[model samples]
Target: MILELKEVHGYYDKSHILNGVTLSVGQGTSVCLLGRNGVGKSTTMKTIMGMLNPKEHCKTEGSMKFDGKELAGMKSHSIARLGIAYVPQGRHIFPTLSTEENLKVAARAGVDGSCKWNLETVYTFFPRLEERKDSKGDKLSGGEKQMLAVARGLMQNPKMMLLDEITEGLAPIIVDQLASMVQNLVAEGVTILIAEQNVKFAMKVSSDCYILERGAIVHHQATKELTAETRKKYLGL
Candidate 1:
């Protein structure tokens, strides 16, 4: 497993939020954290990124391993430096910066002293971004902004990516574009973990699926093995 969480638990103040959440992701595949709102899907991503302290007040317990390295106690920046990139729920780009500048700012070598994504490479996959290269982030449309968010994450040359609710407000046409882009990234061997509330989209994009309810994993199966009936049963779609 490229990423693994074993018996993970977390707390917010005195309220227990995550209870024994465990899952795994293999290399070069997209995995979905499926659940209704208020479940621990988002928190799971945050915990793995080292943004949440499961160790605080000894209120959280679990093991988080990314590429065989223990991530439970590491700082967020440290984790990020390890070549794990996160694209959060909202498309938070530098609104004042031009699209090209935004991409340039995030350009850097991967941990192995190699970068697979640069202007030329990213542009090839997202020609629309190249067209808006000179436009400021705020001037772009919703689809363009989403593309830029994914592009910015690529600039880091990350080994693995954690994407949170990327299709939340995107239109169907734009979502189709993003889905194609995601499949292309997988073809290049980039591991991805996505948190999503949209079960239909998840069924289309993910190879492995885990259903989280009340902060715990209740179902896990290969997407191909999951029936449509099961999806409606869990996701209420």
Candidate 2:
């Protein structure tokens, strides 16, 4: 497995969020974490990225292993350096920075010290971003912002990407485009773990799916194995 979370637990202030959540993602494959709102889908991504620090009374426990190394106590930057990129929800782009600058600021070699994801290469992959290279982050459309967020993460040349709700609040056309982009990423051997509410898009991108409910995994199966009955039961689809 490229990533593994074993019996993980977390708290936000005094509220316990993740409850013994356990899951794994194989290298070079795409996986989905599916759930309804407030079911700890985003929390799982944050926990994996080491973003749920002890501050704000946020505490996490249990094992998070990446590429054979423990990530339970590691800092977020340290985890990033270990080749895990997180494209968080909300598409947190730098409002004042130009699109190109946002991508440049995040530019870094992979953990293996390979600079395969430079601006030119990334621009080639995301030509829309190149066209908006000079535009400020705030001026971009919602879909463009989302693309930039994913592109920024790619700047790190990560081995695995933790994508949290990448398709939220977008037009159907934009959603379809993003689905193709994710497919291309997977084709290029980038491991992806996406947390999503759009079951159709999630199933299209991921080979395997993990259903999360009330902060814990309720089911794990191949995407094809996810039936309508299961979706209606856990995801309320």
Candidate 3:
């Protein structure tokens, strides 16, 4: 396994958000976390990223192992340095910096004998980014900002990526392009864990799916089994 969460529990100000949540990801595979609003989907991502300090009121009472190393109590920066790149929701780009600068900020030295991703490789995946390399992050459109966020994460040359709602409000055409790019990334052997409300879009790319409900997992199955009918019944489609 590349990552595993065993009976993980987390909270926010005495409010329990994750009730013994457990999941795992294998090497070079894509997994989608499906859920409606307020189901602790984003919280799970934050917990994995170490953004929500578990030691605080948000208690974490389980094990999070990545590549055979325990991850509990680790800081966000430390977790990031462990080769887990996160492309958060809303494409949190540095508005004042140019697109190229934003990507550069996330760049790190090569890891595990893999070559680091550079400007050329990012441009190959997102041609629009090349055209707007000099443009400020805030000046880019929604799709463009999203591209920059993904490119920034790629600059780290991470072994796995946690993508939270990468295709939320973009146009259908742009969404299609993003999906294609993700397919290409998977082909390059990058493991991905995507938390998405867009079930249709996720089903098109992920091989497996885990349905989350009220801070707990309700179902886990192959993506092909998540038909429209199943989504309508379980995911409130």
Candidate whose lDDT is highest: 2
lDDT of 2 by residue, 70-145 (tens): 9998899999999999999999999999999999999999988999889998999899999999999999999999
lDDT of 3 at 228: 79
What are the per-residue Cα lDDT tens digits for candidate 1 across 144-228? 9988999999999999999888898989988887787888888888899999998767777789999999999999998768887
Residue runs of model 2 more than 4 Å from their true location after superposition: none
Q: Score every model by TM-score.
A: 0.94, 0.99, 0.96
Candidate 2 clash pair list: none
Candidate 1, residue 218: CA error in Å?
0.3
Candidate 3 is scored at a TM of: 0.96
Cα lDDT for residue 84, candidate 3: 92
Candidate 3 ranges with C-alpha deviation above 4 Å: 54-57
Computed on alpha carbons, the lDDT of every model, listed in order, comes to 0.87, 0.94, 0.89
Q: RMSD to native for every prediction?
A: 1.9, 0.7, 1.3
